[model samples]
Target: MGASCLTDTGHEMGSISLTDTAHEMGASSLTDTGHEMGTSTLTDTGHEMGSSSLTDTGHEMGSFSLTDTGHEMGSSSLTDTGHEVGSISLTDPGHEMGSISLTDTGHEMGSISLTDTGHEMGSITLTDTGHEMGSISLTDTGQEMGSISLTDTGHTMGASSLTDTGHEMGSISLTDTGQEMGSISLTDTGHTMGASSLTDTGHEMGSISLTDTGHEMGSISLTDTGHEMGSSSLTDTGHEMASGSLTDTGHEMGSSSLTDTGHEMSSISLTNTGH
Candidate 1:
């Protein structure tokens, strides 16, 4: 059995269970075993094998489940197999992707086994299980790549990770089990460098480690058997060099060590007893 319902201004439906049910243009709620919905609110149990689509120009939803597609221009809340355009909380294997305006943009995302990518020049909290790459403008004309925490074998690159007008950066942590090369902290005019920690077993060559102008460095530690050459851990002028320690037997050259200028030095320990 099936039911066809239509409402131009407003409509409300409850406790609907059918194989093929169509609804359009209004507010509605369905607790169906399998059905279809359009431009309305739904509390579906097994709709289209737990797959439903919704286009919300302005509406609100609470505790949704299964596969549901919603284009929200206002606000909503979703869980598992759902896509939202406005603001929502989603969790599932399905990818949650959207493009928000600069004036109206704010997201708090936590992805366990999915990739969430968004291009909003506002405040965002992105946690990706895969690769997440985008550019954001925090303030006026100053782009900032907010706190990034990656745990997979992917690369995250931002054109400009800045905070102030002078382009300052916060911190970056890449904890991968494989080889990760060329990880830079800060690279801007008059920009300082934050702490960099690389704990990989593979070779890390030509790694600047930490190079800043007119700023101080935190620390540098190389605990791998791979050779680290051409590492520039030298400062230009009015800068102090922190303690250098190599725990690996591999050779470390000035071209591969971290270098700074016009700033205070923290400490560098290369405890590699072989060298």
Candidate 2:
């Protein structure tokens, strides 16, 4: 099944099964099934599929299937289970994916999941996640992220997690974590962080954790932690650490911890046997 140069109208191609299928130029509503090879290209729009087992290629205003092999460029909302072999890009203005439950096992390079101008992303829930060699950036002004949970995940080789430039973060929880040569930075100006908790963590090889630059912080707790050849800093100007409890235990080696840059700390507690 191959279609091309279909211009200036809405076309619906449904229930197709073929090898080397292509839909290009102003075709809409593509529903296909049992395709060994398929490609939809160049200014095609709006795909709605049910059980379309395809090695699919979609670009520019296209929707995808339940078992689609590859999807790229444009906005799509998929429910049920699917495996994507390539990548998915949601890089148009006013594009959003809401209430998605699926698993993606592939390498996404330079993938912009959500970076829209003058728009806010809705709540997201992800389970059983892992990534290698890419940076996940959620940096937008005046945006808020609801509760995020990561379980049994690992990162390597200088991956960074940044949420900066006046954005607010809700509750974040990490459990049984390990990082190598990675950094977590949250440097937002004039904002606040809700309660954060971390447990059973290990960091090696000069990893740094910083939360700085003029903001307020709520309750933070770290338990059973180890940092070797690393630095932790929390320095800000004209901010306050609200009525919360900060505790550190069982730390070794020549470590440096500082929380001083003309800010008011309500209550602080440091209890350990060694430095």
Residue 214's lDDT in candidate 1: 38
Per-candidate clashes come to 26, 0
Q: What is the C-alpha lDDT of each candidate?
A: 0.28, 0.35
Top-TM-score structure, candidate number:
2
Q: Which ten residues in a row have the lowest lDDT in candidate 1?
A: 100-109
lDDT of 2: 0.35
TM-score of each: 0.25, 0.31
| Predicted candidate 2 versus true structure: per-residue lDDT over 193-228, tens digit per residue | 664444435555244343445456654444435655
Off by over 4 Å in 1: 1-149, 153-170, 178-195, 202-263, 273-275
**Over the stretch 104-146, how does candidate 1's per-residue lDDT look in tens digits?**
1212112221112321112222222213322222221223322
- Whose lDDT is greatest here? 2
